[model samples]
Target: MNELQHETSPYLLQHANNPIHWKAWNDTSLKAAKNENKLIIVSIGYSACHWCHVMEHESFEDETVARVMNANFISIKVDREERPDVDAVYMKAVQLMTKQGGWPLNVVCLPDGRPVWGGTYFKKDNWMDILGQLQNLYTTEPERMMEYAEKLHQGIQILGIVEKNHSEAKSNPNNIKPLVEKWSKSFDWEFGGYARAPKFMMPNNYLFLQRYGYQTQSKDLLEFVDLTLTRMAYGGLFDTVDGGFSRYSVDMRWHVPHFEKMLYDNGQLISLYSEAYKRTQNPLYKNVIEKTLTFVERELYNSDNAFYSALDADSLNEVGVLEEGAFYVWKKEQLQQLLKEDFEMFAALFNVNDFGYWEHDNYVLIQSQSAETIASQFGLTENELLDKKKNWEQLLFNEREKRPKPRLDDKSLTSWNAIMLKGYVDAYTALGHEHYLTVAKKNAQFITDKQWSTDGFLWHSYKNGKSTITGFLEDYAFVIEAFIALYQATLEESYLHQAKQLIDYCLEHFYDEEKQFFTFTSRDGEQLIAPHFETEDNVIPASNSVMANNLYVLGILFHNGYYEKTALQMLHHMIPNMDYASAYSNWLNLWLNQSDDNKELAVCGKNALENIRKIQAEYLPNIILAGSTKASELPFLQSRFDEQNLLFYICQNKNCLLPNTSLETTVAALKIS
Candidate 1:
């Protein structure tokens, strides 16, 4: 086995026995690079990355390629999930240098850890050629090579400064309105999604639009979110045959997908859709949530109740061919053979054709016909047709299970769990599903018990009973957000207390007093070139933005003036970046629409608790709920509150009104705003 066998990350362990001598990304490896005066080759990827695995097999596992890498460079392996801060830093560099970046990120850096050149994957022979060229340049043109390194290092420094300096102009409220208008104008009205060819499941944007619609009562905004959610629910981006959403659509219509499923994306989007359902009372939204939860339970859930990261996009088919959509796609002949007399009906319903939906004659599972059309065509009632479709779905799921499943990235990450915890908690409230609450509580407990350190710090990821990577700001921020949500759902004091403790730790360790924003890592943690403060939205919301929203909500719930002040300060700090809100809409949303009236509904005492739960079961977006009770008594309200509550106060603007101990008064108070 290679030295990577000793590493904790499953991604690294996957390469344990490869011919490559892979060293974990650490000071030891960096020091070795410096000592040997060798160029450092850093390859960054996560476990469920299909291309990462392919690259590993093609290059890292090949003896000749390994020899070339070993002879020419000091190789270091990084699991992007384990060290997102590092990944973010280098990914920015790669994107700036090459105009694009992705995993398996292959970069060649100088001994001092400054990246000089990089790209994603390269063929074995091509890689050898590049290695020879780089080596020759370093040997013969040392000064030119040093100059190139200096330029790259300076470029990175400039990017850091730019990132640090981004903030919306707070001098004029008019500044943000234009940006909001710009985003609104960019909405794809006909399609119900954003204007783009390759569409992403951008829950953040949809969520922002939902909030915008509530604030402005714009029919366009509401329609955009509603149409997008419904279309996505009926499209290939959503696994109509299984459950849960794929990562993104490869086409403009959301009809074709890249096929990878990520837990964080599913978790966040499920909550968004559930909240939309609550607002619209749309059965389609509810159905989407149900199917998504089924996917999570069947595929992503681990034994510990913590969710896995993702499922690979690629799976081997029956013929042993590595096909992208093989598991999901169906051919005309195959459907006819399987369904017999029902084949035509099912084919028409699912859009199955001889030509198929994808390249290479593959077919993606889709809902081409409306429920009414399918019912009429099949000569059955809507309920009967739905039941038949459900039965067929089960058949497909069972059959797919028998085939090669996509490789699971089983590593448990604190940030991801925090995101999913909120998802489960929100879904529990929206659907009144007890099982969702159970999973959320178990995962929260797992994180608090296993990932928390004695020093009040949190680790990022865990695998095989070992947790090693130091937690980043996202881990602390998102987990705290999760705890706060769990507290709201269950009205348990402990979760709130724990969340407050985490907030304190973040303030002490990660907060930049001068900058008024949280740093990506603690000041005393491992030294990078600069302490990053991420404000842009990616697949998940930024740590800074999520934590800012978290703090704002906590302030409202607890009536803590200081927390609200801190939140405002953080938003104020990020105000200048609003010009680019289209790209960072998730972060910008927290600051764009100011809520002048935040109603707080506080239900205290035993009699009011049941009513409070009933109120919570209904979607209340702008209100915060808190119950003052012992943690032990939380279990009785677990089905209602779902195990995290006490000292309940639901308010806005940090000025909670008098606590209402009656359900009627609580409802009346909540309805006021």
Candidate 2:
């Protein structure tokens, strides 16, 4: 056992035996830097990050490198997954300084914890050069170094102020409509995804398009979303043999994937596809959702019902070690040998030509072909072809399972739990699957029961039965959003009440009253010199945006104008950062939809509740529902609302259109948009 054995973070545990004196991010290390007048070096990365692993092996484990690092600086290691607050602050600094940033984030700061200089993944040979340069600059030109630090600090402060002001402005629906239109115009028509070389899933963009299409009844919006999703489903970015999507495509056609699979990414994408299926009634979309869920269950889901964080892109194969996509590719001969008589038909359906589809090697994902085409080609009935395909898929899935699986990072993160919870909720509603709801409730309970702190705050993550890191804004915001969704799905008052509590905690602890935006960390917590307010969205939605949505829903549910006003204020503050919102279209859409003309559907009493649950089982997004049912009793009525002789009031914009308890009338009211 090593000294870091006491740490709960998977990343820290991975480095437990390293010769480097790596301290977890804490006040102790920062204070030590101040007391010793030594530079503080903060290295940030998550467990599944490939470069982080490489740097750990190449430098952290080297006794000579560790000796130098320990002697010269107070080294602190942070798992970005565990402490996103710290990562966000310094990642911004690194980006500002270098115009780029990534893990392993290597930063050197002054005794006061103001970053002076930073660069990521210094080679062992280059480390001596970089270290020598920094040390010389620090010792011989202390004044110059301090001046540079002060300038960086001031720059960050100014950026913070500007971001804070921008996040407070409420965007007009009209302005957002044009913004959405502008982004849609830039979408790649020939290819399926957004116009870019390296393409991401961009589930947010698809979600916005879906909502906008439904809201405006725009054919183009609907077509755009459908095309993008269909293309992604058939692209190599999605696993055809197994379920789940890779991180992103490295090429334009979505043929070559970067190959890392993240739980949060899959969770969000599954919800997106499931919603798409609900809207379009497309069997392909539904199939994609089911397969993705299977992938999660097979690989990421722990025995405890918690989902793991991610799977590494790299893997070891018979041909030795390889980069991402190694395990996914296959030669045509290999498939021919495996499938025998079915080889040619299968190859044709999967676009496996002699020349190959991706990098001259077949990466099998459904490219183009309806079941009708397959049936016609095989001279069989559609049902027969479907059965054969199912059996063939099973065979392929079994073979793939024999290969070495990607490394799983089994650290459970609260933000990711919130994501998966939403996925499970969506799956349950869309498919009417009891197991999905069971998993959702179990995971939600795990988070609240296990990760909740004695201080009445939520911790960010848990690993091996221990929760350690402090929760950031995203943890509070996203989890509350999940609870709200769960409340709507189950019509459980407890989830709503719990969500309200989280919202209150965030407002009290994280809200920057002066700045008019939420801080990433609480004011009373271990102080980083510059507390950041994240307005821009990343892979997950921004904390500010999620919180803004939470406030909006809570305001409507509780009829608290203060919460509503706060939500609007947050939108207003964020409007100036509209450029940033381009990448975060889903959140912007949610905010814009609320700002336009928000509707609340309140289902009261047993009869109305039964009808409402039936409508809710359809998986309608953006509708907020409040019920009077007790938390414990809510899960029993998981099925759609039963038609009964109970009075139900359908309220939109606080106006109740004639109360009718019948299922038909309730369904009619819900269908009114």
Best by lDDT: 1
Residue 539, model 2, lDDT: 68
Query: Which prediction has the highest TM-score against the true structure?
Result: 1
TM-score of 1: 0.91
Residue 282 local lDDT, model 1: 86
Clashes of 1: 26
Please write out the lDDT profile of model 2 over residues 84-128, one tens digit for every residue. Answer: 878877887888899989889989899888889888877887876
* lDDT, residue 565, model 1: 77
Q: State every prediction's TM-score relative to the real structure.
A: 0.91, 0.90
- How many steric clashes between backbone atoms does each model show? 26, 13
| lDDT of the candidates, in the order given | 0.76, 0.76
Alpha-carbon deviation at 115 in model 2, angstroms: 1.6
